[model samples]
Target chain A: MRTKTLITSMGLFAMLCVVIFGLGVKGLALDETFRRFVLAALWVCTWFAAVVGLNRAAASDRNKSFFSALMLLPFDPALVYLVRLVSTLVWLVITQALLVLLAVPMLKFDFFSQPLMLAVALMADVGILALGVLLASATGRLRGGEALLTIALLPVTVPVFLAATGATEALHTGSGAAEAWPYVLLLGVCDAMFLALGLLLFGKLNEG
Target chain B: MKAKTSNAPLITLALAALGLIGAEVTLYLSYFYTPVQISAGTLYVVTPSSGSTINLYESYRIFFIHLPAAYATALCCTLAAVGGIAWLLTRKDAWQALIVSASEVGLATGAIVLLTGTFWADYAWGSGRIGSGWNWEPRLTTMLILWLAFAALLVLRRAMDTDKQRAMMTAVYGILLGPLYPLVSKAIEIGQTSHPKSFSDLLSAPEIATTKQVATIGILLALVSMVALRYCWNRLGQRMAQERAA
Candidate 1:
């Protein structure tokens, strides 16, 4: 089941990449710089999809064995949450790097021109995924969970979305990280704050 | 019982009407009675000069409506958040009703503010200068999302069959997501984008003394009227639901 979930998520990401690149090349006729922005957005979406997929799979497989496995794990639940958060961030960064490579040939400038953009994007993703996982946990236990999940999560993540869009724009304009770092920092602060809060609240909220 | 039950609705209607009258009077004074003034040391240029002349016109009228609606929405959001927290802590259905009422009113006022803001932005910023149409600036984007969130909460409430469960879940969302408004506003301000500052800072001396005061009064009255109406509607709905259950 886990393997199927992973494969389906990867397949969705691959299809998304193909469509985005095709549109960038054929439809929008976007320059390399703009293509990079689109690619970054796609990468973020891909990571988000994978995390969501994994969350849904875990939620559905709420059997005794699974709970036993979780109980037997050496790490604490908080530690597990941290590890998952870090792994998701790593996956997002890797996808972003891959996007940067694909975007390099079609662009007007090199990757080094917008180092801060990469950082901002990664931080924004971390914040989003952190909040997503938290809300997913809450909604996973509720009836009509998926719809409730979207409603609860989307508004909370608006700041991250705005920051990422702004940072991406700054990168394309070659405004440097100085202009965009504050937004990146804001996302980082929000991620850290919310992660801590979620960890503290998770036990109470998760109890049936 | 019917006579006694009807009194609450009557009182609510009377309060709403009085509040509406107050709002209208305030609007009249703001537009017709208030004197317009130029900025300090900034003279109006009749001829070509280095500085451009600023005019107070129809666009400024949006302020008469926008400020009050924005404040009202903020007030409603606060009330909703408080009510949600109260419901969570006390486990009271009355608090849940209050949360629902406030959420609905907040969503309505938010929509009004966004509409007025777009009109103001069109005239003030010049259409298409920022973006094609309704540029997704921070304030606008945040307000839009907040409005949608509240609307979704209301919808979720209606969809649920059991009142207790519905209220519980909705209250949780209302409390958790309520803070996003301030966060979004601060994030936008920090980002330094095309979102407009509230008119409190931009008014000239005469405009501030006359038009600003009137607008502020008008908005307060309107907000009171809307909230009263919504509160009454919520109470009525609760009563009806009780009757049905009985």
Candidate 2:
């Protein structure tokens, strides 16, 4: 089910946005700042894709198969959250990897030069997917929940977006990893905080 | 029939009245008594246009409202999270009431902070140069994220079909909203921000510091009053909704 949502037009929709973003910028392909722009666009598109994936995943489970089964589980609810997070995270990572691959060659940028950028980006993915899964589950079963998912997910991920983009920019701007560490640390902290909340609250959400 | 919801308890009424008086006094003090401050770092608002600078002279008054609203936002966020956890543990309606009330109030206060903050950024930091100064400063940016989370809580609440679903989602999201408060408060410290870096500069002037503190406390009293009143109304409203559904 998750794969179905991922491969269809919505996935292309996000990828298309990145194409527009890249092509829309005049002379960006030749410019040195192209990599940074590509990173920024990638982050936005990745977030959009993650939100769509999360929403679709939760909607598929809306008949209460997931939660009802959760009720009968022998293990703790937090473990349930972790399991779902990992599943969502895997898909998001794959999508992002595809994006990075596309942007690196099709857009022609040096991603391998600064490996930390990818590290920070993947770390941010965990945070976004962690919170997105929790919120998507909560809103998925309700009427007009799709609208809520988009709106709620967009704004809440701003900090993560900022941190990822900041670190990317800093790394590519000739400052090296030294200037980017603060942002990376902040991103790590946010990721941990969101994951902790997901583990703690997603369980309570399943309880009566 | 819908039950009567506006008859607040005596303590709330008293607090509201006291808050009103305090607000008035704080406004008076901030406006008329606090002298114009020119601290070292805050002394100039450099206009990027002509390479000139200007004193924030009169525009700094917005700080009184800006700071307090931020304080109230943090307070309400904490309240909502605490109430949410309590509700989760006990499954009590009163705890749910507190959760909704604080979320609603927090959204309002967060808006005030954002509005006044942006205005201050344009006028004081930009030196009346429009759209030049604040371009997603870390502090303001993160605070906006926090505000959006509060709004998301409301959206989640409205979307739920059942009361228990609403309560459970709100509790979880409200708790999720907790970490952002610390991030907002520390964003200035941890990174580059367009906001006044530290209160040390603003605190140098005894009168300004005192007035600022008085105004912050005063506004907090008024906002707390609002939160309490809203919590009471929320409890009554929940009961009415449950009755209507039944």
Candidate 3:
């Protein structure tokens, strides 16, 4: 029940963000200025919604003593970090899918038509959440943790996000896979780094 | 364990002195040794009375301060990340102190990198507009992000309550910063169409290259001294925290 609420709220929040962003660029045609700006705008709003969702989810876990329950378990805490990342990934996947579904028409971009860009977006999510899970846990237990998590997470992920948007743009324009593959590879490198750090350091997030 | 020597202050003082000397030599060489080839500086009239034949590359002199700060920024970040990883493994207070001190120094040097970079950008790429010292170039953007992350780490490091929490949080933040520099470095190999590359061509001159090497060494020494001094200060705080806990 709790997880359902989080998924719904996060999905709704993402929709709200996409709608606001759409309003900011209202009346821009599909193949004109809209195409140029839509890719970056969509990714930014998605990441924004993702960051907020992660912060809220982590906060609730701590508040309800779910974190304490996990800490008391016999298994390694790093496993908890991985499990939470997977669970967060699942909820975010649902919410973000809804967000993108809405994004397709309002933004006038055939997001579903491009399999490559969708792959890029999914890869981008791994890097974001991998670092996001660790930073969220580290900051969520503090005062003003929500704001700090967003502030801290965004800058660290800028390079990957930049590459994600660039790759998405390249693929959307009918560019060949060869041209866009480098950006995808960069995303992979960052994702690996983030995941490795999460697995290595998640156990140290909050002491036992 | 043996009693530690009281030479820390003297050692720090010597490093600071060496850094100062390096700065002095670098500046002196930049002005007097390097030949002027660009039409980018105050044009010296070649009157028979004046010994001036070539124009000085005044803006190029920023490389001395700029390159050193860039090197120091990278050094401090690497130190912080290494210290953070070591702390996580060993759980030692000195390692914790090392990350904190390195982070503070890195933040200072990162700001210098941005400020100095803007100066270079304006001179090299600006269209003679006021407040046009910066653009959204890829490498510049990467540097800015790295600087902002440094600031965020220090800020978040303060919000933790206990010693263990602070150390752990800071270690994670520092380690989080680890992959970013390399990623950006790699990313710049593509899509960096606008960064000024003429400066590199000019650096083939033996004088400028040697001067940069000297300046980098000197500035790194000063920055490292700062980290060491800060580490000592952080160790003092750690002792107080332990004493209070006892």
Best by TM-score: 3
Q: Where in model 1 is the C-alpha error above 4 Å? A: A4-8, A24-36, A43-55, A58-118, A138-148, A200-206, B1-11, B35-56, B130-133, B159-165, B192-202, B205-208, B239-246
Superior candidate under TM-score, 2 versus 3 = 3
Candidate 2's DockQ = 0.63
Can you give the TM-score per candidate against the true fold?
A: 0.78, 0.88, 0.89
Query: Which pairs clash in model 3?
Result: none
Residue lDDT tens for model 1, B1-246: 788667877876776777677778767866676555344234311111213333434456667778788778877777887887787678776687778878888888888988987766655553566564576656776888888878877866665545555666667667755666686457446554455443333454465456567666666666766776777777778788888999
DockQ of every candidate structure = 0.36, 0.63, 0.69
- By the lDDT metric, which is better: model 1 or model 2? 2
Model 2's CAPRI class is: medium
Query: Is candidate 2 or 3 superior in lDDT?
Result: 2
Report per-prediction Cα RMSD to one decimal. 5.0, 4.0, 5.3
Off by over 4 Å in 2: A1-14, A26-29, A63-67, B1-8, B36-54, B127-130, B241-246
| Top-scoring candidate (lDDT) | 2
**Cα lDDT tens digits for candidate 2, B7-49:** 4655687887888788888889888987865553454233322
Model 3 CAPRI quality = medium
